[model samples]
Target: MKLHNISFNNLRRRKTKMAFLTIGLVVGIATIVTLVTLTNSMSSDIGRKMDEFGANILITPQQNGLSMNYGGISLGGVNFDQKEIRESDLALISTIRNSRNISAVAPKVVGAVEVDRHQVLLVGVQFDKELKLKQWWNVFGKAPERGDELLLGSEAARVLNVMSGDTIDIKGEKFKVSGILDQTGSQDDSLIFSQLPVAQRLLHKEGRLSFVEVAALCSGCPIGDMVLQIAEKLPAAKVSAIQQVVEGRLKTLDQFRRFSYAMAGVVVFIGSLIVFVTMMGSVNERTTEIGVFRAIGFRKSHIMRIILLEAAVVGVLAGVLGYAAGMGGAKLALPMMAEGKQVQLVWDGVVAAGSLGLSVVLALLGSLYPALHASKLDPTEALRAL
Candidate 1:
């Protein structure tokens, strides 16, 4: 019989053992595939949300004192200089080399003030640049075109029971409401926007700004490093990278993913053990057949090859099936996992190739002991066994 025929016959004769071996491989492959796919999808989901925040960098006035605590445990705070950034600082940032991504800049001046019966936050914004910074803002009516007209966020409009074409009193001065913005679930949703000059004059701080919002051209930009370098140059201003603010949460998610991968490794290890036991049992049951092959001048290497081929077949089938199942599960679960945010699923080719290769190698390793025993079988002793 040909070598292929021998392998096929051997597997058919030991159906129970083959089934058990395949099951073990399937378990291992499934765990690895699911965890890897989920992790990759999750990282991409987070990155997309961060991009929605618009600016890559945020320049803010340094806070004087702040502290955080958990369960009565207090952590110290770093004292920061509270100097406000000027238009000259904005000009300086614009001059940095490799600053092509710095698209539009807008300074914000925030203060608490009373608008009619309700107290609200007043945010000063430049008309042309503010529109660029808040591109997602949906306006119900006409946007503010003059100093006398102001735009209210959805939440603020609701609180004041006001709408576009209404008038509201701020600091004893009546202002016309020109627009109401859509809800964004952000701080902006609770504030009102007006001309920067009007805000600075009302707040009694002319030519001063609380922070600068910088919209960067995200394509092929190393935003985090650029923000840091810009911060170093402007020692008086505090630079905040939007990416860094959310990096801690991202890191925590990454650790969770690593833990999942570790658990998958354990599952694969158990699968390897199952393969070893099943293969060993098959070798014991086929001792007489092995002896027949030996007597017919089949080399020990040929016997070893047949056993390894059976393992390889099981591994490949398991890998292909598991990969298919894992991808289906990911597609179904991604929406739930991301809390209604639609995230793109990326099947990393490197990960897929590596997983398939590892599965095959693991199967070969599991078959090693059985292959060795078959190779060293004594033909005389095996022929007398039955």
Candidate 2:
């Protein structure tokens, strides 16, 4: 019979030991897979929600500005060209190559207006797009539902002594205060939000926009490329990406990923140790059988091959079982841990193949010393015990 046949037959005879060893490796591999899959899922979720978090790009008209400094002296007179972005031209933004990544495009027209005799800044916005972009906004009442309705910022509401359902006159037209924006501690806090077209007519700045805020997917897909694409489509507008938010999120996810890897490594190490100790014990118990084989003219390499072959078979079985269990565990755990978000698990064939290969490598490394010891068993000494 062939030496490999002997190895297979030996494994078939020792079902208990093989089963225990397989289980050890399976648990180790399963833990690694679960952690890795969870981390990947979390990263994807963060990337998707990046847009809802807020705008990552700000589009404004490109214009020249005068420096307030003169010969490094104390002179401080500043002048800048106040270029107005065209509201009609904003549609061209959808033509960019990366337009699919844009989640919201909220344009605004800002002007000073009198509300209840108090001078307040009025910001014209498309209520639909603005609400979609600002997920953090907590309105005390309803958002504007009509052209004659506007939202009052907390500070602006206080100054105007107005609340939701109050009426105010803007440029000889009555407008309803539809809602009061909760304090955001942002520039939005001190402004009154009006419908885009209504504000355009009220401010007498029809066809003009102050600026546009864009929410882009931030899965590290080169925001710079998006900026370049936007600039190409809207050459009159200066497109710039706000990297602080994206960078901060990316950094947080990266740290979490590193922690998962470290944990996986530790689990793998413990698994290798379990396999090594079990393999060493098996080699010792098989000493008499190995001696008999050596007496029958089997070489040391043949003995080593038999031991290592058993390990390889166990590794293959363990790897497959581990991957299945890990995927199941992750699926059950995702909903509870992901905070109401549906996490889509990615099953990569390459990852499965790599996992199987890693299992074999781990097993071989763990069994190397025991296999070597088995090979070195002196026929005379082994037979003396028999």
Candidate 3:
């Protein structure tokens, strides 16, 4: 019979032993696949949440300033020739090469207004954009949707002694308190928010913007390139990335990826060890069989081929089964791992191909020594055990 025929017959006769070897390989491959798939899903989910966290880019009017401090003494400098960033100029941001990375753009106009003889920072914002940009805001009431409505911060509401549905006067304009934000421990807690057009008119700075907040942190997004592009597009505006925020989000996602790879590496090593030990034991048990083949005019190469062919078949079988099992495990584990976050399972052809190839390579490498030992066995010596 041919070498492959002999290999197939041996596998059929030793079904239990082969089954154990296959199981070992399958477990290892499955563990690796599950980790990789789960990591990718979790990373995607976290990326979406990070995008909702807040803006990582800030754009403001450009101004020239001079430092007057000397000998570390307290001194104030003058800012001159300040340039305003037109509300219309914000459209140039959408023309950037990486503009698709931009998530939300919130432009604001700011000015101080008096309420009950107390000066309060009043901010004009596009509520639709602001609500989308600040997803974490838990307003006690509702967002302001009308120019005659206002959203007050927790501290601002407390100072003004107002709640939802209360009316307050600003610059001779009466606005109803639409909502009071929950305490966020930020500067926002002391500010009053109103519709963009209303605030612009109230501040008498129509068609002008104080600053813009851009949510542009996405997977593999080039924050630096975007900043430069925005600066180029709006020459009178200062565009900058919030480095700490960008680095923190990137580092978090990277940590998850690195951790999955590290775990996969450990499982691979154990898998290799399992294959080596099992194949070596099988070779020892088949010494007499190998001797018979040698005595029957079968060459050393033929004996080696029979042993390796068996491993190759097992590898192929294990690869298919392992990939299926791994994907299932990832699906089941996602909910618990993601803590209720919705994650879509990915069926990657590349990952499937990779797993198959890895299994085959590991099997061949692990069985190499045993195949060599079997081929080198002295026919007479091996036959004596029979």
TM-score of each: 0.74, 0.75, 0.82
Poorly placed runs, candidate 1 (over 4 Å) = 54-57, 61-84, 94-105, 110-122, 126-136, 142-150, 155-162, 165-178, 183-190, 194-208, 214-228, 240-248, 331-338, 341-346
Instruction: Show where candidate 3 strays beyond 4 Å.
Output: 1-27, 34-38, 70-72, 252-270, 293-306, 312-353, 372-384
Better of 2 and 3 by lDDT: 3
Using lDDT as the measure, the top candidate is: 3
Report the backbone clash tally of model 3. 0
lDDT of 1 by residue, 209-272 (tens): 8898887634346777778777877777788767655666577777979898798889778888
Residue-wise C-alpha lDDT for candidate 3, range 1-386, written one tens digit per residue? 77888899989998998999999999999999998988888777767776877898999999999879789985999999999989999899999999999989999999999999999999999999998899989998899988899999999999989989999998787899989999998999999999999999999999999999999877778989999999999998999888686577568768877988998898889888888998999999999999998998888889889999999999999999999999999999988877465677778898899999999988898999999999999999999997
**lDDT score at residue 92, model 1, on the 0-100 scale:** 78
Model 1: weakest 10-residue lDDT segment is 216-225
Residue by residue across 1-386, what tens digits does model 2's lDDT show? 89789989989998999899999999988888888887777777777677667787899888876656667885755657757689888888898888888888999988998766788899999989999999989998899989988898899888888899999998888988889999999988899998899888888999999899998866766778988988888877888988786687678778878988998899889989988999999999999999999999999999999999999999999999988988888788778756565667767676578678878888888999999999999999999996
Which has the better lDDT: candidate 1, or candidate 2?
A: 2
Query: lDDT for each of the candidates?
Result: 0.81, 0.86, 0.91
Ranking the candidates on lDDT from highest down gives 3, 2, 1
What TM-score does candidate 3 reach? 0.82
Cα lDDT of candidate 2 equals 0.86
Error of 3 at 58 (Å): 0.5
Candidate 2 residue runs with Cα over 4 Å from true position: 1-31, 34-38, 69-76, 255-277, 290-361, 364-384
Better by lDDT, candidate 3 or 1 = 3
